[model samples]
Target: MPLSHNPNLLQPRVPILNWIADMGSDISDEIRYRLCATLASSTLPALLGSLNSFCITLLAYARLQNTILLYIALCDLIFGVMRVCATNVSWLRTVAADLVVVSGIGWATMMAATMVVVGFSDDTPMLIIVVASGLGSCAGIIARNYAAPRLALAQVIVIDASFKIPFCIHHPEFIPLILLQGAGFIGVAIWIMRQQRETTVRAIAGQIESRTQSLQDPLTGLLNRRGFAEKAQSMRQTSSTKALLYLDLDGFKQVNDRFGHGVGDEILRQAARRLSICLPNASICRMGGDEFIVLADCHSRQEAAVIGARIIQTISLPTVTSAGQASVGVSIGISLFDPMEVDLERAMVEADEALYRAKRAGRGCALLHDPAMSGASKAMA
Candidate 1:
């Protein structure tokens, strides 16, 4: 019979679509937030400059009208691009050459409206006003780009409101369109921010399960070989004294041979439980079969030896068996790290050698090795 499909068979995960949606949302929020800040910061100077230019342009000769309007148009376009790039691309790049031409146009327009250039006339009060206004607008733009966007945007809104009275009196037709555009941009930014928050939450949650699985041993709930290796390497780097003990259950093969494989598995499980209990802080790992490794941060070589001896003593105790009573002993080899010889792989090898010595000495013994001195050789003999 065909096996029935179970929806629960598939482990729960954050759907890819949801993750993508969230990422998009977060990016949009960041963009909106930046845009708001930029606009707010520049608004005051922009308002002062725009109003000053608009009034001067009205008072100034028709001969200068073309240049002034061109400058204002350029300023608007330049600022629009700056806001876009700052929010959507690089958040921190304050000086953008791409915006230079537009800024130049805005400067020219502000000059045209305020100071009538009948000749090379630098002495006029109107000319001074125009230059000062242009500089203020430029300063605002720079400040907005460099600082937090929210404050900048708030300033812009205030300046824009102040300018609206004059703007309506002089050119009432443009006010409605400008307000609509600003509102639409803000709405889009809000939507994007919502998407971004959702995405980050999902991304963080999805990574948790993946990391847990990687760090955990599926069969025994101890650290897996990979996790053990990582901990050993970390300990080797930061620790002054570290010990790795390699353990192999004595007569494990005979147990597998005499009892069924299931009974042998039960014994291994029981062994793993006892080892975990004994080495609470140490990273305990099953290196497949009956071999296991424990990486411990010990105060001294004697401490490592004590831990190894305890492991052997614990595993040698009587274990409840399915068919009858069964007991097993563990042979353990421990290697303490020296400042000179602290390589992770070499430490493991020395520990393995010590374990071999313990197995040879007797099935139930523990052997400790110091790379600075002789290890287990005398005991084995």
Candidate 2:
């Protein structure tokens, strides 16, 4: 007491020391009563969280498997009851077996108890009703995430039926309570089913939207740059050899210069449609402005050269623009990927350099990269 007369040191230790002292209290009489109160107070939120999570699970089950909506409802009621009961008594301590038993017994018992209480309210004692409901709720909470929904529901129905005969024969007045509980469970189940349907529809819609975005180009409705990269990367990784052609449209400036930007856009769209028909397996992309890239499968350098030749010939085809007949040819540079040799980006670079050579050589032809002749090209660079 003298040491604590100074407020500064005494105040700092007071709260922590009080808490520590409380933990050491003897578990008898006054201390026991306080401990029980503290435990019960803490247990309430945990119980509530369990109940909320069960409700969410029930909704998820309903949405994911619509055919088992009724089954899920019954399960939810059973597990809901088990969860409530388990708070007061730890029925399944071991993590392994506790999981299965909780779902099986807890959910089934609740449905059974509800039916008995609903049908024979007059005869069924308050103690029996409490025990059944509490045990059922605890079981549902601890059960595995996806143990058959219908089996759980069936067990509940069986239990409910078993409890009814005795109460109806001897004490008919109790029938109302049993019916009430059954009806309540059915009502909750129906609500869960409706929510499940809405969620399922929403999920399906989201998937469709995601697929559309993946396949489509955001600005052009043709396949995007991302779509091209994925296809090219996959083929290069799996196959023996392939080719990439980089094309930058020559005389595209004339369209933008004479007719303005809008006509230039229409020209690009028309170019995409016409180009897509030229090669079946090839992927084409607009790499900003008038630049485009094409990737095609090939077994040898000769096959790749043939594809590049076909592309150059196709681009030279006539198109009727606002400035009368606009014949726009492309300068194409070819780069080939070797399974044991070149990397992905290096192949594109070689193709790009070849493209610049074509442009310098009067922009209508295709140029392929040859490592043997690269020293000469390097000197020019």
Model 1: residues with Cα > 4 Å off, grouped in runs: 1-198, 320-325, 370-381
What would the per-residue lDDT of candidate 2 be over residues 191-288, giving only the tens digit for each residue? 45345434543555566678769866665556677777776666655656777778888888987788788777767776777678887777787777
Give the Å error, residue 67, model 2.
33
Task: Kindly give the number of clashing pairs for every candidate.
Answer: 18, 30
lDDT measured at residue 268 in model 2 versus the true structure, 0 to 100? 79
* Candidate with best TM-score: 2
Candidate 1 residues 17-120, lDDT tens each? 12211212333443434333333344344445545555554444444444654554445445544433433344323332223223323443434333334223
| Backbone clash pairs in model 2 (N, Cα, C under 3 Å; residues 3+ apart or in different chains), count | 30
Among the numbered candidates, top lDDT falls to: 1
User: Model 2, 5: alpha-carbon shift in Å?
Assistant: 68
Q: Candidate 2's C-alpha lDDT?
A: 0.55
Question: Candidate 2: minimum summed lDDT over ten consecutive residues — where?
Answer: 3-12
